[model samples]
Target: MDWKLENIILGVTDVDRAKEFYTQSLGFHLDVDHQASDDFRVVQVTPVGSGCSVTFGVGLNGAEPGATKGLHLVVEDIEAAYAELEGRGVVSSGIQHFDVATGGMAPGVDPEHRDFMSYVYLNDPDGNSWHVQEAHHKGAEG
Candidate 1:
């Protein structure tokens, strides 16, 4: 069995705003924006160099305009990313740390990872939320 991460669904209050955010701020390329009905649109975006894609819209299987949460995007740099977002008028939700001692946000992020990692949250006008993560610790050696 080969299970692979395919797509993420990001529910946004406004499709245009979400499209602009993902494309302009996060550098995701718009793949598809299919309008299936008068009440909904299917907007998909793919990261510049990623096989995974995220889809957002409305009226998806009881998914209203706002019905997504806790979506994580693993990134390479946190500080530079913060600066870019700031330049684009986006605000951070404060720095979140991982507990190194317990592997659960130990008084800030682990020091071994250069202590340069953190997550800053942002929200759209309709309260749709997303965060930028600055570290990659998948195999326990990152």
Candidate 2:
């Protein structure tokens, strides 16, 4: 059996603000924004090359606004991704890596740019955090 992940429902306080942030700032493709009534609204947006999408709007889920955290968006090039997001005016944390020995974050991407080692973080209007992780391995060494 093949199981595919589809939409992730994010509870945001404002629908229009979240839509703008995802569409304009993050460059996600706006898939849908439908409101049948004042109590029901659904907005879906997907990243450029992602199969999974995110949905947020009024009365969709009971989750609290800004409750989601640690969502990862894997990318092939950390530097390019960082530059693109920064150029688009998204406030992102400087690329950093986790130090296993000290269990702390170190400045800058991993020296070798190893897969899963480098990351840059950003937050949406509702404070839902997203991590752009470098997941491309150049070769056996990387």
Candidate 3:
């Protein structure tokens, strides 16, 4: 059986604001915007080259605005991703890597640009954090 991850629902205080951030700042493709009533609205957006998409809006139960965190978006190049976010006025942390030898975080991307080693973080308007990581080995079969 094949299982696929599709949509992730994000709790957001303002759907329009979230839509703007994702579409304009993050450059995600706006997939859907639907409102059944004043109490029910959902907006879906997908990152470029991503199969999975995120949804946010009103009337989704048990979702607290700004509560979601640690979502990862993998990129082939951390520098390019960081540059794009910066160009869009998104405040992102400097590229960083965890030093396994020293067991501490260090400034800059991984020296070797190793998969899963380098990351930069940005937050949505509602404070939901997203991590962009350099992952060059994804989908390669052993």
List TM-score per model, in order: 0.70, 0.93, 0.93
Poorly placed runs, candidate 1 (over 4 Å): 36-40, 99-111, 114-117, 136-142
Q: What's the CA error at residue 8 for candidate 2, in Å?
A: 0.3
Candidate 3 Cα RMSD (Å):
2.7
Q: Name the TM-score of candidate 2.
A: 0.93
- Whole-model Cα lDDT per candidate? 0.68, 0.89, 0.89
Looking at candidate 1, the ten consecutive residues that score lowest on lDDT are 106-115
Give each prediction's root-mean-square deviation over alpha carbons.
Answer: 4.0, 1.5, 2.7
The number of clashing residue pairs in each candidate reads 5, 0, 0
Question: lDDT of candidate 3?
Answer: 0.89
In model 1, what lDDT does residue 142 have? Answer: 60
- Per-residue accuracy of model 3 over 1-142 as CA lDDT, tens digit each: 9899998989988889999999999999999999999989989999999999999988876458889999999998888898999899999887998888998879997887778888998899999999998888444221
Candidate 1: clashing pairs of residues? 98-105, 98-106, 99-104, 99-105, 99-106
